[model samples]
Target: MTKISTTQTQDMHSALTQAIRSEPSLIGGHEKSLKGDAGDGSTVVVSAEEIQLMGIAQPWDWKPDPVGQITMEKFQFCDLEPAKDSGKYFSPGGQSFSSGYRDFLALLSPDFQPQSILSAVKTTNQPPTSGASKSGWLNVLNNAGQLEQKPSYSTSESPEGWIAQVSTQNTEHKLTLEFESGDVSVATSSKEVSVPPDQVYKIQITATAWQRIQIFPGTWYNQAIITIAKARESQYLAGGMAQVAFGPGGLINSRVSEFVVAMMPSAVVTMDEQFASSQQIQASDIQQVKVGGFHFSKGSPESAAKLQPQSVFQSASAGSGKTTISASETHATHPYILAVIIQKFG
Candidate 1:
């Protein structure tokens, strides 16, 4: 079984970056919900309750394995077989399989046992801080005491009262969010669509950038909404499913139902406007779409299938349909993630 060694992290990220640029179909019209990302330098520790809650709320839905089985707490990917599958990447060939978030910790460090993590784990949800904004988006202060609403798809959300919320951060309008369907023109789109986050996958990330984008603290864990602008000509970002996750423990964000605003605003993010404008994405616009949370496999789907969508967010896989070494597939289309700026941190 091939596992993702930390050494391969950079290599994998580089491969994905290049792959997406070369393959448009890989990204296309995927990435539905813009799951909030962790701001640069922001770190949120995953709690034990969150992990347990997922286990009880959403456990692994596979039946007798292709190799062995392990209860996965979060939605993780492996181009070959989604971590949920008793397939490849994990304890294969019927090797010793353990459950819980410990699986991830194990990957990070085999010596870090589940028992140790179980004891050390604690549910500590902190309140807003002096430097943070509860709004989940960037909260920049201006001379007007409020940010003027940019001409865009997102409605005018006053940053005045939100200044005291659990928060921080801000955005641009010429947004390009392509999903698996492969529509390359998100910059000019004008329609609004509601799509399941799982159904639409994203690959908007770079090796250096993804490293800095952490999961929002006590993050929504579920998917959130995204507003793209359509006013001007923006450079083509990334372009394929390779931006998603290939190996297990790859970067996976929240999962939920998102209300997409195809109203491209044609906005721009200059260094000056970085901390100046506050295009707040109201919480009302976001919700959990997947039936059993992110781990939702095909069972939740009407077809009663598994390893199809939902829980599976991958482009380069190994075992699901392909065999032997590894395989690559696409379910994305456009790129909008940043390299240095913490674009969305909810």
Candidate 2:
């Protein structure tokens, strides 16, 4: 990853803001939720708007140019054998027969032993059960006692609280918790309140800035979470989810969530007399330079004067033996003035 300076970050933010303002479709839209398969073989549902914003198009849709590409050579599969019945291939004994199969097998031979085919078959015959039960063979042999058992737990109702509304003003952000009996409003900058007794409140951090505020039931923030900054109004959501506005008058807008309610665990630095030491400057060997008769010391003035001649242009001793010298009287002053002018122009 490339490191970016603070100025670059600010510039990027400004450019992004300008792009969003110029393109309304970038943020304002509603689409059907699409179902897709996750890498883990699990089902995932996401809004079509999100897919569009991610720059992913349909199979036939046009795509932008690629920034870069990675090329790899000498890629091969090991231990793969052609199937007798079909064109497919298989690796026998759960071992790869790839290009480096021998070296790989030798490295693992000491610690890993392949299971026997008969042992694997015997293990597959036994079914996993929760509670004690007679095995099929035992049952066939007229055994009566249970061989396996599974434990069960009782289910009871628990008190719960739901987030009703989340709003923000110029000063602070507020979160309203809805209970069965009444509602409780809490501000981001306010003192921490003990969660209502006997109630299991779900606290979810929906938005870190001004964007869609989701009121889901669950405890998301706790003592483990820390607050870094006060909440404020913004135009973008987490992960760059654009805020959309609707209605004829644009009165209907996306939900406004807190900018930053809490953060995660961080180390705290304690300051004391021992830790609050000041920096000591060591100027034992330093140099002094003269520019246009003006003495500029790199270190202590007293030390610089001891090593160099005192300036004659001292206003305090002008009438005394010391004479006041102007830049016009000194021929070396012209070169210094010219250097300054060149530096400024360059």
Candidate 3:
């Protein structure tokens, strides 16, 4: 093992002291550009409401609803298996796992799972294997352009005493940490304090989750955006769609009504992003796909007059996802499977 001289250790500590000073509050709102980190030139926007959780710190007494807190060790499954019979949560014409449904279950498959050199997940200030770079680098954007699920570790560490936080529009948990001290010192070394407040809480993502899940069942599970929809047609009868709540258009939401599906739930359902107020993973229920006025038809997208163009995917629909279909495609499967695209009503 290579040994670090006392001088090098002190230098590392001194650097951490200079790097981790408190950042100015982005109270009302803030917008960060990822033109550099994510190369694709996307942007993260924060409205005043969102900034309360993102830039600004929440009050000590803030307690969210539903008595939320779940542990992955005890957390049950998402019912990945197809509903064996025509019953609750199962649409009439849905297909079975054999008909293209195995693709999703493959997330947990060891033989096919992708291997990423992820840091050993820890809830405490256990130093990462290396400390040459900055420590508090949380909310990291994956180069693969997909929200990959990190291995969740169970812990009961409280969220109190957190001095700094890094929240994002992508991942479920907002990383929070109470530094060992305000300044790094030579005596203790930098390893302890350099790791920013981090926790491996339960994760949840938005529309992107349906795009491409990178969990390695055994292989490096990666599917480019172009071929994500390849298995759409074979999943019919397995893609749930019976008795889903409806709307005016063939789909209550026309912006999202097309593309292939063979087997799935009653509709192209959308799961809510996970928010763990506590250190434990909380239970979640099936969510409805929320839709909105922001239309990206034939390539036109919702715009900010003077803002930088931050949209990444060049599409309105037609990608991965078993039950989901684009507006045109949703109609083709209509009356067959209800395209209950939930509306994210403002």
Pick the TM-score winner: 1
CA lDDT scores, all candidates in order: 0.20, 0.18, 0.18
Q: Give per-model TM-scores.
A: 0.17, 0.12, 0.14
Per-residue CA lDDT of model 1 for 51-149, tens digit only, reads 101111111232221111111211121111112222211121221111211122222222222333322332111223554444322232235665321
lDDT of 3 by residue, 133-165 (tens): 222211222356532232221212112211121
- In TM-score terms, candidate 1 sits at 0.17
Instruction: Please tell me which predicted candidate would have the highest lDDT against the true structure.
Output: 1
Query: What are the clash counts of all predictions, listed in order?
Result: 45, 19, 50
**Model 1 per-residue lDDT at 186:** 11
Decreasing TM-score order of the candidates: 1, 3, 2
Worst 10 residues of 2 by lDDT: 337-346
| Candidates in descending lDDT order | 1, 2, 3
Tell me the tens digit of each residue's lDDT in model 2 across 70-174: 011000111121111111111112221121211212222121222243234233334435443422211111125433221111111101111112122332222
> What's the lDDT of the predicted structure labeled candidate 3?
0.18
Deviation of model 2 at 9, angstroms: 1.6
Candidate 2, superposed: residue stretches over 4 Å from native: 1-7, 11-245, 248-251, 262-346
